[model samples]
Target: MLADALGQVPYFSAREVEALVAAWNKPITLRRGEYLVQHGQVERNLYFVKSGLLRIYYPTETEEICVGFAYAPNVVCSFPSFVHGTPSEYCIQALRQSELLGISKNDFAALLELLPNIARFWREELEKVLVGRIDREIDLLLAEPERRLERLLRRSPHIFQLVPKKYIASYLRMTPETLSRLR
Candidate 1:
């Protein structure tokens, strides 16, 4: 799965995959409801999801608001924390038993210096994340719930497969009942 994710990058070769696997060779596992990076913790690692599902959510005084999700073959981390050595704003929790590969910031930095292709790939991934966030913001700005649901369904119907209905509702900024009604 890691290889498949990396393989999507331009100029990412088998050699690059080997380098990535070697750098992130540490295996990690999480059962359902277990946190990968708890809120307020400094997240020093980048994670590659081999299998299972995770939700990134922001905790408030009353509730946890879903922000995003990660599933099989996906790379996920507290990006702000990983990049700036800051505390994470969200809790990354496994929604199902999850198998993952983790690499520390130091190791990833070394890999970036050692491999140019990996660096390019990382930049492109970051760009995509940025664009995705912008797109999501635009989606949320729409006043109608149906439009929001429609856009999400059009863009990432697979999210329905990765997470449960409640979290999906939260991610869409709607109640579970509302989501159901719309569906």
Candidate 2:
């Protein structure tokens, strides 16, 4: 899966792809409810999801606000923390049993030196994340729950296959009952 994802990068050559596969050498496993990242923790590794699901959220006194998710064949990381060496406010937790491969900051930095093309992949991924965050902001800004629900349905129908309805409701900034009624 890591090779396949690396292969998709337009700037990567076959050798660069193999180098990435080698760099992502740390194996990780999580049972349900395990935390990949927690508030105040600095995230230093980029993870490739080999299997199962993860929830990206922010914890608060009242609730955990569902913000995003990562699943099999996708990459997962606390972006700001990973990039800036700062502590993350968000938490990434396993929602089900999961397997992953991770590339540490040191390894990735070395790769950035060895393979300039890999930087392109990182930039593109960052761009996508920024765009998605902007779109999610717009979705949350909508006053009507129905509009938010419909927009998500149109934009990410496949998400229903990966995440539970409760998290979907939270992502839409609505109660599960409200989401149920809207559906």
| TM-scores, all models, native as reference | 0.95, 0.94
Question: Which candidate leads the pack in lDDT?
Answer: 2
Please list the C-alpha lDDT of all candidates, in the order they appear. 0.90, 0.91
Q: After superposition, how far is residue 4 of candidate 2 from its true place, in Å?
A: 2.4
lDDT of 1 at 23: 85
Q: Cα deviation of 133 in candidate 1 (Å)? A: 0.7
Task: Flag regions of model 2 displaced more than 4 Å.
Answer: none
Candidate 2 lDDT by residue in tens digits, 80-172: 899899999999999999999999999998988888788777778789988988988899899999999988989889998889999999989
Residue 11, model 2: Cα distance from true site in angstroms: 4.1
**Candidate 2 Cα deviation (angstroms), residue 147:** 1.1
lDDT of 1: 0.90
Candidate achieving the largest TM-score:
1
Q: Superposing all C-alpha atoms, what RMSD in Å does each candidate have to the true structure?
A: 1.3, 1.3
